[model samples]
Target: MAIASSQPNSPAHPWPSLVPKTGMIVTLLFVLLLLFMLDIALGSVHIPLKSVVAILFGNETGQVAWEKIVMTIRLPKALTAVIAGSALSVSGLQMQTLFRNPLAGPSVLGISAGASLGVAVVMLASGGAANAFAIRQLGLGGSWLIVLAATAGAMAVLLVVLGVAVRIRDNVVLLIVGIMVGNITVSIISIWQYFSAPEEIQDYLIWTFGSLGGVFGSQLAVLAGVVTVGLLISFSTSKPLNVLLLGENYARSLGMGTFSTRMFVILATSLLAGSVTGFCGPIGFIGIAVPHLARSILNTSDHRFLMPSSALMGAILMLACDIIAQMPGTQTTLPINAVTALIGSPVVIWVIVRQKNLRASFS
Candidate 1:
């Protein structure tokens, strides 16, 4: 990423100051590292920080049980947290920039809801018998099934939004269309749940609560791969995204294809948000809250900086939340979704309150 020109009179939209933000960016990366190690170190069973470090470096920890917990359980969980946080945060940043709305996010736009619906169709809408039949006979089970279904569902919603974007120039109207579409998706899922078997409902409910521990091995690899692609796609759009911020008409004047830009963003968002929802469930707040935090800290709208900044901030926040949800030193654990809501709700309120007039935020 190009650093903002140090020259004051440069005509190009100035990027955030490099000197201060570089330090902040480095600090955030340091914090992410600390949190990753901390998330692995703290759990229901206490493991010494030294042992955790040793195990990570392939040293013999001497205690097999501690080693197993660190390597098999905590390591994957912590990695998943980083991936999920970065994916959701960057996806949110893209959405906010694309829609030019402070509140625009995957969850807010119903993209996650759409993903959940796709999973629901596989896990809940079909009778347990048919689902089992498909899994056993067709070999369509496990992580791959859910991830594909979720991605498809998210893509479906994205297409609708894109269709609306083509004809409607007003962002407010587009935002409302997204919300209404998402609500419809949620309602459909609710009705399916109402008819689903109790056991099926229970399983789906657990998925909704969200868990970083659920992904491991091949599943973890898949999540990481998908999120990485999404992040790259978003990063590639930094220049176009900057032009987009000046409004579509100005963007068109500059020979940018507004529709094509929107397509790239939606595609990236689907991969990022959908894969996370499929593996980790519909994680909220990280997407909506992290971008604002990055913007506030960096004091610039440039996507090049905001993308990485949000990724680091999002990972930090997610790891911190995961630590809390684990309720270390106790067997009792809280749902990640609940903890995220507790944290994210206040941030949303802050965005609204601080903006005062919502429309002015985009302007």
Candidate 2:
């Protein structure tokens, strides 16, 4: 009172402090809850909020169709968005950290393209013979064959990339190799597309459109298991990943098993990215953009904080995008890839622009 403080930026005596982590967590939980409710309420078929809530709680007496919609359709779609988003985002963060490159992600590494090639082979080059044989012998059908082919293809690419990463010391060069790998795969796919029938080409084209709603309850278990294992593997190596932030020589000096650490990271990334792409199609932009968004929000590059934050932020962003994709007023939904690109590209560009010195800094 006697004298005004000279420090104007002191924030008027700390200003009661920012919200605590617990408060932030609670707020995020509430936001997720609201988003979940919105997802249930605003689908193609109009369901009243009360009925949606009742259906969720198994108390809907006269709303069987609503219950079915909420439980069978929208719930799985929402969960897929959450799980796929978290998995892709966390995987992207791990890749970026391991490579010391902000632009690294599963798609950029051509894992998705590998998966796409696999699907193309199965659907086109395999002569649709495998599908017929599976339906006849094992009772397996169309999409299941595609999923298996995609998963196998993604894993194969992962192995190749891991091998290359171990041999190549430069991250930028490795990235270029990954891009080349993707291009090669695309060329193979194009060849197959040219030789395949129009109907098969249409099917492949539709699959490429990407959709979170593709995973049903029956397939959720497989998706959940693979993603959980992948994430756990990544989480366990947080210490190594953190070490990796310092150059490989520095990590070796610090007693880290550089080769093994790199292998595990690559495998984990492949699993996470592959599983999501296998089930949801090649989801674009989420992996590349979400990690940067998390870094910006947390203001720290620590993997310990960044991974979890990226997971949550990714889930929220993906869920919101899926909701928009549904386009409640329209009968048809927008492609998930398109929505993600529209939302994520600008953010990525901003990150690149704002961090103009990132390349030199990392180098």
Candidate 3:
């Protein structure tokens, strides 16, 4: 998690010039609203924007089916996209700041993999298989069960990573350990898959592909609650994260306890990443990409600005991805993971190139 500069705005550092924060924030909010409405309107049914707005405001849209679709299906899905997007992006921002690495993301430490492992246990493990029929029969209750399993799995891994983090001084080594742990978790999932029934394997596979539509009603409420708590934790640590950007020794010199701060960050990230994975499956790219996007757009490293910017940008991106996944007028829908990957891959390449430029400028 160490980087070269121990001072955030040092004279020799090559950070980008700051932009007008207020303007950018307002723009992001407006875009988020636009995309939210668009995501609801452009689904397979193509409900008119007017009707969507009308239904949202408690007015009769005349078409009962449109009202039901907007209120029941698309609205919940859109909200899920917003919540999940912000959760992952904020988690990524915190991780990147903690590691002082542009590529650090929620998945980087295998937290998402751990969550998946939890889901795998429920969906594919021998004991889970025996109760699979009953679990599905439980419907929304079953979904909550999976959410709990995923959160537990994520925390199980977080505990291991934190245990290692406390003993390891090197961020790079901790990163390697996290990756190794994640790989081991994936291998365990694979072993479970191999022995499970084909139907069970298929169910687990769908979960990996991810879906925002799966969360709604009481499920949406739970996801929202979890994410709100995580974001508040992340936001409260903005000052600590800033000091950390100056390196651990400097942070300690400033009266911050390095160990405690690190633990809090890891815990906050686990809650956000773990809960989102539990509810929406493991969403990729946004966690790794949105922070960089926010940093670049905002042109500063201040967590105060970066966190909210990342959240709004993430929500907008997720809503856009969801709309594309719906394929608009077509009944066919693409996997949200696939859509995010397609869009996120390019942003990552840009990040690499930008980092290279930063290095060259510093040299």
Cα lDDT computed for each candidate against the true fold: 0.82, 0.79, 0.85
* Candidate 2 local lDDT, 157-215, one digit each (tens): 77777778889977677788888888988999999899887867777787798878768
Model 2: residue 247 alpha-carbon error in angstroms: 2.1
Task: Count clashes in each candidate, considering only residues at least 3 apart in sequence or on different chains.
Answer: 0, 0, 1
Q: Write the per-residue lDDT of candidate 1 for residues 1-363, one digit (tens) a residue.
A: 344456656568754355436788889989999989899989899888888889999998679999889888899999999999999999999889888888789775678888889878877866657664564353322457766777788878878887887898666677788899899999999999898888777767777888888787998888899899999999998889988889878988999877778778878888888888878888888898888877767766778888989999989989999999999999988989899879666865686567554444466
Candidate 3 residue spans exceeding 4 A from truth = 1-20, 128-130, 136-142, 347-363
- Candidate with the greatest lDDT versus the true structure: 3
Q: TM-score: which is higher, 1 or 3?
A: 3
Clashes of 2: 0
List where candidate 2 sits over 4 angstroms from the true fold. Answer: 1-25, 128-142, 166-173, 347-363
Give all TM-scores, in the order shown.
0.87, 0.85, 0.89
Best by TM-score: 3
lDDT rank order: 3, 1, 2
What's model 1's lDDT at 268? Answer: 88
Root-mean-square deviation (CA) per prediction: 4.0, 5.8, 5.1
> C-alpha displacement of 152 in model 3, angstroms?
1.4
The sequence of per-residue lDDT tens digits that candidate 3 reaches over residues 243-305 is: 888887898899997777888888889889998998889888899888877776766777888
Model 2 Cα RMSD, 1 decimal: 5.8
TM-score for candidate 2, please give it.
0.85
